[model samples]
Target: MALNPNVPANQEQRTDEIDLFELFSGLWAQKWLIVGCSALALLVATAYAFLATPYYEVHSILRTTQLKELDELNGTGVYKIDPEEALRRVGASLDSYETRVSFFNANRELFEPLKKGSGSLENAFAAFNEEQFTLLQPDPRKTSLVPFVGLKLEYPADVDGVAILNGMVRQAISDEKVRIAQDLEGVIKSRLNVINRQLTAARAKYEASKENKIAGLKEGDEIKRAQLQDELKALRGELRLRRQSRITQLDEAIAIARSLGIVKPTTPTSMGQDAGAAQGNIIRTEVFNQQFPLYFMGSEALEAERNGLLKRRSDDHTEPRIAKIQHELQLLENNRQIQFMQSREDEDLFLAALADLREESSRLENIKLDLSQLQLARVDRPAIEPIKPIKPIKMTIMALGVVLGGMLGVFAALLRVILRRKANALA
Candidate 1:
């Protein structure tokens, strides 16, 4: 009992060191017990792995081909629905509970096999929500200009998950097509309405101008008469210029035709003195007939004449025929001027407005064609049967079990050693 303070402190330090070493040695002595506990945990893990049902996943790819860029109609740009955005909304809609419920309801038989343990359709739907569904675009983080998306479905290994996914994809595509058509139709109809209104306004303006009668000379309005005279003079000048241009075009066209051996004179040898005169007359007639066939005859008659003319051959009499053709062309120009002079300013406006309305009508027809032909989205790749189950990775589960079981066993052994030490101390 007469121990020094330094000796007691040293003894306590030594005891602490021994206790630390004894902990490891104690665990070593009960290594077999630890191994047995680990073996039991491994067996439990194995049983759970075998008992759990495996699930397989199948996926399909979709492509959005809707008109994303602004569409050009009648030289004006119009907005169109973005295909990528529409596809994104469709994907989001698929993820919604309501859409999923609808899908389940529509194809209850497909989901029925998934309801092995479920009590009713609702419970089956609940089970599906818990374990079977995922709809998403692939690689959303990556910036891609292409509108590619993916839909995935998981089910029990025995179920036809691929068929279910395919059905869903088909339904989605049908719905999107209908939506795109309706939207495009609405846009086209709205634009048509606007164009019609504009046309109406233009017609009204033209009618009002006619009622004002400012385009023509009135009986007592001297200033208006002078203005009409000036307009008439300008019209005459333009008509004369157009006539001259037409004459030139006709001359060149006749020369080209003569060069091509399409125009000819029928010379008769029986009438020796009249032969040259007959040839000249025939050439003039042929030139006039070819250039202004529709002027004298109906379109059908003109076509018939053209067919007959095509059968005839001609010799090159370019130098002598030019003067005669020029004379005939002058007569045609004189007739065109008479018709042009008869047209009033109001009549010209009306004709211009009519042309515009016809153009608009043609544009509307094209829009209708586009609506009918448009395809918004399509199934790029269909889902197929999965070769392997995605779930219940046995190796991973076994490895996890081994590591966790070993740690728990070690903790149990340490606890046993500590309890024995306490019992011994109490004794």
Candidate 2:
């Protein structure tokens, strides 16, 4: 007989192929085994459900409030807290070993029952677990704004978990407030120091310029001229001093605004119309100072001409020449006083800058007051005692046990069939 070309060279490969119906029938034949295993698992699950200690979860909702006032005085907008970042920080803090120990100590009454003999306090402290605390940001999807955060604590039902969780939240908020205040104060002080240094330099420059100008003038018999020069110098010095003072005040105001979490407005170079006029006056004074020597020389030439007329014994010429010389001298004196007028113009500029600084400072002070009064975190919902136990859900445990038992039974029945077949093939 000729061997069929379609016949397999290895019959073992065909034997390895599994039939679903046959496997199901094999399992079905051991129905009592499956039922007995399932019943044993159910009994164990029921025993565990009754014996395990129940846990109660207590949770609270906290809403972060405005640490700084709304509508900043400097028009920079209000400061906002990042809820997600804050939650992460608070979570880490609560999970710390030190924090957990502190929490347990603070609520000693709650954990007293957990204490065992002579080392009761030590045992109680050891019972504190970082895992018991949880911090969650409820609306993570709302990234545009920080959402309210939730804090939860889980402990045995016998413990006062609600009180412990509430206390922890309050302490965390207090620490946050202190941290923010210290940071703001440090930044403001650093900026204030820089402004102070600039102000000192400006004042020194103004003083040095005033002294140099006064010392440069030559002494002469022109008493009126001397007096006018002194007055003009004094006026210029006063104007410069005022300007420096106003700048210093403006810096202080800006610092205050920054401390309140407000964007500090740019320090203005000019205070509107008055500042423009002051700048113009400064330029005009510089030009006049340059031309002062020419005016003085002209007055001296007129005086010499009048003396020559007197020596020639021409009364008519002498009288007219004297009058002309007097007129020229008066005009020269007026021109010299132009510097004093310029200084007066600059006074208005300094005054305007000072006014602006004062207004800004006042607004910042008001904001600071408001912030001091505001609370950092408000309790939206205080934690309460949980109504039901959270752990060892009976129904879920029993269902899992039943499924596992059925799977184990089917596996065992299949293994028995495979071992018998292997033995027969060996024989």
Top candidate (TM-score): 1
The residue-by-residue lDDT of candidate 1 on 101-196, one tens digit each, is: 766778888776766553876887787776767766767678877677777888887677887788777666555556666765677678778878
What lDDT does candidate 2 reach at residue 425?
A: 43
TM-score of model number 2: 0.47
Distance from true location, Cα of 323 in model 1, Å: 50
The Cα RMSD of model 1 versus the native structure comes to 25.9
Which candidate number maximizes lDDT? 1
RMSD per model, one decimal: 25.9, 29.2
lDDT by residue for model 2 (156-198), tens = 8667787778777766655555555565555455545654565
Candidate lDDT (C-alpha), each = 0.63, 0.57
TM-score on alpha carbons, each prediction? 0.54, 0.47
**Which 10 residues in a row give candidate 1 its minimum summed lDDT?**
285-294
